[model samples]
Target: MNHSRAILTLAWREILRFLRQRNRVIGAVGQPVLFWLLFGAGLESTFRLGESGQSFRDYYFPGSFMLILLFTAIFTSISIIEDRKEGFLQSVLVSPVPRWGIVLGKVLGGTTLALLQGLLFLSFLFFTEMRPGLFEIGQLIFLAGIAAFGMTSLGFVLAWRLDSTQGFHAIMNLLLMPMWLLSGAFFPIPSLENGSFLLHWIMRCNPMSYAVSGVRQQMDGSFLTADLAADYWFPSLSLCWAVTILFSLLMFSWAWKTSSRRVQGDLR
Candidate 1:
C-alpha cells in the first residue's frame, strides 16, 4: 500500500458509499430537524431560559444542530460493523496498510459526512428567529467539526468491537442517548447558586454539555448584544471550547489505539 494513497482511497470509498445511499442523508438530517420542530412546538410555552429570555425553539436549535452532527456521525461510523461482517475489514487488516491509515480514513470520512449534514442544518437557520451571521456561522462550523470528529471516533471505537448492527444500536442507545439528554441538550440545568446539585454536576462532567453550551452561547443573540458573555446559565464559552477540544483529542487517541487491536473474527 502506498500509505497516503490507501488512506485517501478508503476515505473516498466511504464518501461514495454515503452518496449512493441517499436514505442515510434523510435519516440522519431529517429525523433531527423533525424532532426539533415537534419538540419546539410542544415545549415553547413551558421552557423559558431564566435571564436569557430565549424561547424554547431558540434554546433547542443549537442542541438540535448538535444532534444533526451526532446523527450523521452515528450513521457514518456504524459502517465499520457492517464492513467487518462483509469481510472487508478482515481483508483490509490482512493488507499492508497501517492501522493508523485505516483509522484516519474512516474518521475523515465520518467527519466529512457530519460536517456536511451540519452545514445543511445551518441553512435552515434563516427560517428561525435566531440568526447567526457569516462569521458566527464559521465559528459554529469550527465547533461542529471538532464535535463531529470526537463523536465519530467514539462511535468508531464502539462499533469496532461489535458484530451486528443491532448490537451497535443497542449499545449506542444505552450510551449516547443518556449522554445527549443529561448533557443539558434537552433541558436547561439550574445554575450552581439555585442548586440542582447532582444534576448540575453530571452536566458539568459531560463533554457533550460543553459542545451544546458553546453552540448555545454563539447563537443566543451575541451578534446583536454588546456583551459577548451574556448567558451565565451554562459553562463559560472559553471553558466549553477548551473542553470540547480536549474531548476530541481524547476520543481520537482512543480510536487510533483501538484500531490496532484485534477485533473479533480477525484473520490470523
Candidate 2:
C-alpha cells in the first residue's frame, strides 16, 4: 500500500484499539478529573490569583486538560513496546513500507488518539461555566492538537529503543512527569523569592512550558490581559507556537532516525 494509506490504516487501528479498552479510557479521563476536583477545591481558598479573585479551579482548568493529553500520549506510545515484544513491530519493519512511513504511522496514530482524549476533557468547560468565543475554542483545540502531537512523538522516540515495558514506564515517570510538573501546568512559574534561579531557569527551558502556555493563553487571553499585574508567567503566544512546532518536528525526526536504526539492526 502507499504511504498515505499505510499511515491512515495504522491510525485507524489505534483509534479502534483505544475504543475497545474501556479501562484505559476511564483512567485517562478519571485521573485528571479527580485531580481537578480534589486539588482545585482543596486549594481554591488558599491559592489566590492576585487581585482578580480567580479561584484555583479556574487557574487549573488548562492544566487539567493538559494532563489528559499527557496520559493518553504516554499510554498510546507504550503500545509500541508491546508490539515489539509480540514480534508485530519486527514484522512491520521487514515489510516494504519505508522506515519513515512506519514511524509516521505510529506517531500519527498516537497523536490522533491523544488529541481525541484531550478534546473529551474540554467538555469540563461547561461545568466551569467558561463561555469562550467560538474562535477561542478553535484556537485552543488547534494548540492542544499540536501539543499532543509533540508529546506523542517524544514518547514514540523514547519507547522505540526500549525492550521492556517496565523500563519505559520508569523513564516516562522520571522524565515526562517532570516535564509536565515544571511546565507551569499546576502553578505559575514560582517567583525567585520562593524558588531558586535554577528552578526558574528549568521551567523557562522546558518545551512543555510553552505548550501549556499556548493552551492557557488561547483559552484565557482576555483574563490574562486584564490581569497584567498578576505574577503568572507565560511566553508570548507566537513564541509558544514556534517552540511547540519546532519541538514536534524535532521529535518526529528523531523517532524516524531511531526507527531506521532499528530496521538496520534487525536486518543484520
Candidate 3:
C-alpha cells in the first residue's frame, strides 16, 4: 500500500477504535467541562487580577482547554506501546512504509483526535457564556490544533523509550505536572513571590509557558495591544504559529533520534 493510504487506513482504524470505545473520547472532552464548571465556579468569586482584568473563570478557562489538549496528546502516545505489545508494530514493520511514516501517522491521528476534543470543549464554553466572540472562538480552535501537534510530538518521545504502561505513565506524569504548573495554566507566573528559585527557573524554561501565555493573551484581549510595553510579545499570531511549528520540529527530531537509537539498542 502507498504511504498515504497506509496512514489514512491506520488513522481510520484508530478513529473507529475510539468510536467503539467512546468512553475515552467522552472522558477526554468531559474533564475540561468539569474543570470549567466546578473549578471555575468555585474560584470565580475569588481569583483576582493578573494584570489581564479577566476574572478567574475567564483566565483559567483557556488553561482548562490546554489541559485537555495536553492530556489527550500524552495519552494518545501510549498507543505506540500498545501497538508494540499487540503485534501491530510487526505488521507495520512488514509493510513498505518508512518507520518514520509509522510514527508520523500515529502523531497525525492522535493529534486530530485531541483537536476534536478541543473543539467540543470550546463549543461548550461558548454556549455556556464561559467564553464569547465568534472570532475568539475560532482562534481558540486554531490554537488547540497547534497545541495538539506540540503535545503529540512530546508523546512520541515519551513512548520511544518507555517499555511498559506504568513507566510511560510515570514519566508522563512527571513531565506533565511540571509543565502544566509552570506554564501559568493554573496560576499567574508573574504573581509568584520572588522567594522560590526553582519555580522561577521552571517557569522560565518550560516552552508550554509560551503556549499558555499566548492563549492567555487571546483570552484577556491583549494580543495586539500591549498591556506591558516591556514584556516580550511575539508581535503577531504568525510568530506564535512559527514558534510553535519550530518547537514541534525540534521535539520531533529529538524523539525520532531517541526512537532510532533505542531500535538499535544504543540507548538504555
Name every residue pair that clashes in candidate 2: none
Better of 1 and 3 by TM-score: 1
Please give the TM-score that candidate 1 achieves against the real structure.
0.92
Question: What Cα-based lDDT does every candidate model obtain?
Answer: 0.83, 0.82, 0.69
User: Which whole-number lDDT from 0 to 100 does residue 132 have in model 3?
Assistant: 42
Model 3 agreement with the true structure over 129-219: per-residue lDDT tens digits: 3444678667756766777777888888888776688999898778786788777678755423433666666675677766776666555
Top candidate on TM-score is 2
**Predicted structure with the largest lDDT when compared to the true one:** 1
* Off by more than 4 A, model 2: 191-195, 225-230, 263-268
Error of 3 at 195 (Å): 6.9
The positional error of residue 29 in candidate 1, measured at the CA in angstroms, is 1.0
For residues 82-183, could you state the per-residue lDDT of candidate 2 as single tens digits?
A: 777777788888788898888888878888888887888888887774577889889888888888888888888888877778999899889999999999
